[model samples]
Target: MTEANLTYVNGEPTLRFERRLRHPPAKVWRAVTDPAELKHWFPAAVETELRPGAPMRFVFPEEAVVDGAWDGEVLEVDEPKVFMFRWHQDVLRIEVIPDGDGCTLVFSQTIGGGRAGFLAAGRTAAGWDSCLDQLAARLDGTTVPARTDWVTPMAHYIEKFGLGDGTVTATTDGYELRFARDLVWRKPADTWPVLTRSLETGHVTKEEPPRVLEYEWSQGGTVRWEFVSDPKLGERVELTHTLPATLAELRPLALATWHHRLELFFAAATGGVDESWSEDRVAELVKHYA
Candidate 1:
């Protein structure tokens, strides 16, 4: 196993990284600071000491083979397990601990302040992330292809900036809401009417069987949509804000909505929601009923 985990905390724009090395402190230490070894995983450059209060210069020779270098200070350094530093306006923490048959290494950074702050933090974080992955591969005696020419999608990268608690909740005018249960619906002929009505009434704005469905809702001006899918069934539909108020008021409100919607939706195809209904099966019955 490669000795590292990298995570970008969404809300508070901070980088949290960790790695478990299969080697001892001595070997891990050398891999981190030895100029030759560091170059294997990091940018082509040179280094001085991993010590406290010392000015260490690591030049990305490749940058100078163009024209620049990043300079920083070594804030704290302890043999084998911990190293802390400040690099170009960011706080960097590195931790190495002895674990079972090897060592664990961790790197963390917190950077945020201004326009330059975002750019600097992002670049620094991604650069370190790629470099650390290289470090892990090297320690495990593996080879990694260098991605020097790669360009990251900025939108996708920027999306990582939002660190909202994964919980979805919204409140307005005494209505507090959250997602209850989400399901993907498939085209079961037994449920044709519901599907037909759903599509006809604009209840569904998008469709890709088993992929996604978007349902819209509006209550006294507040509006949002629930996304759903049933990948296994190859037909998935999402329920949006079309449920009656009585059902919407329930705790985990979405659950009640699903129960009510699914029942009505399938009733059109299966004569009832309790029985299994396939598209062909329902279609045959639907034609007879028609």
Candidate 2:
């Protein structure tokens, strides 16, 4: 599978992916257009005639279902070369370039505007990443289970898009942290002062004893801490950070700073000192992220 490339086109977020397969253009084209072959890898089972201006309906399985079928119209159909369609408010395009006995497939989707668009960019890219992986497996004649884990790949996409560097368990208006641990016997109210004092800045925004505490970071983000009961981890603390898009050059530094601060928070809460927490360690982290 190829890495998804994200860019802004006409102020709208667009995601593009390319894959080089050993199969010829016609074999790849049929796999994308034919419903029987598509069901093996595509998110939905497609129904339509192979032609331009044809109406298409995408049906999801009962076990892995969505709200309803995705209805779309084929915009262009140049056999074994290009297939373009209108999917919801987004345009999906596929181009096949012959490469000797093999072919390269380019897929692009234009994501529209609003709060949802920004949030969906990472998710959509990750979904396509998995689908393309599955497509590759199918072409290679290997049987693999459907992918149910999106957290790992979504984190990669989030970082690739220069949003932030953290393990994202979930993403809505902002990204959710993947770190969750039982903080020994500490409660949210008791934790708040330690967090504030250690950071030396940031004011508390919302505080609910033992449950939720939120604060605004002086640097440029909001941090929320929540305590919840987990079946496996028992009582655990979850932290979430929301940050605006920053300049590309500053992303690595910003990510390292946040990671370092989180380390400090953990040390303060546990009364444990990490010897690795030093300038050299931070420089190593910056290099790793870079």
Candidate 2 TM-score to native: 0.59
Error of 1 at 56 (Å): 1.6
TM-score of each: 0.47, 0.59
Candidate 1 local lDDT, residue 106: 72
Instruction: Give the per-residue lDDT digits (tens) of candidate 2, residues 74-140.
Output: 8998998999887656778889999989999999998753433444465578888888888878888
Best by TM-score: 2
Model 1 residue 60 lDDT score: 51
Whole-model lDDT for model 2 versus the true structure? 0.67
Lowest lDDT 10-mer window, candidate 1? 177-186
lDDT (Cα atoms) of all candidates against the true structure:
0.50, 0.67
For model 2, how big is the CA root-mean-square deviation? Answer: 10.5
lDDT of 1 by residue, 1-290 (tens): 33222355555446676777788878888887667887888665645566687775656544333223445678887876677776555567778888888987877876644333443333444566678878889888997887653124221233254211012234443333332221123244333335544642335455444334444443322223333323221232333343444443433433333334443443333233433434554344334323
| Candidate 2 wrongly placed segments (more than 4 Å) | 62-66, 165-290
Among these predictions, the greatest lDDT belongs to 2
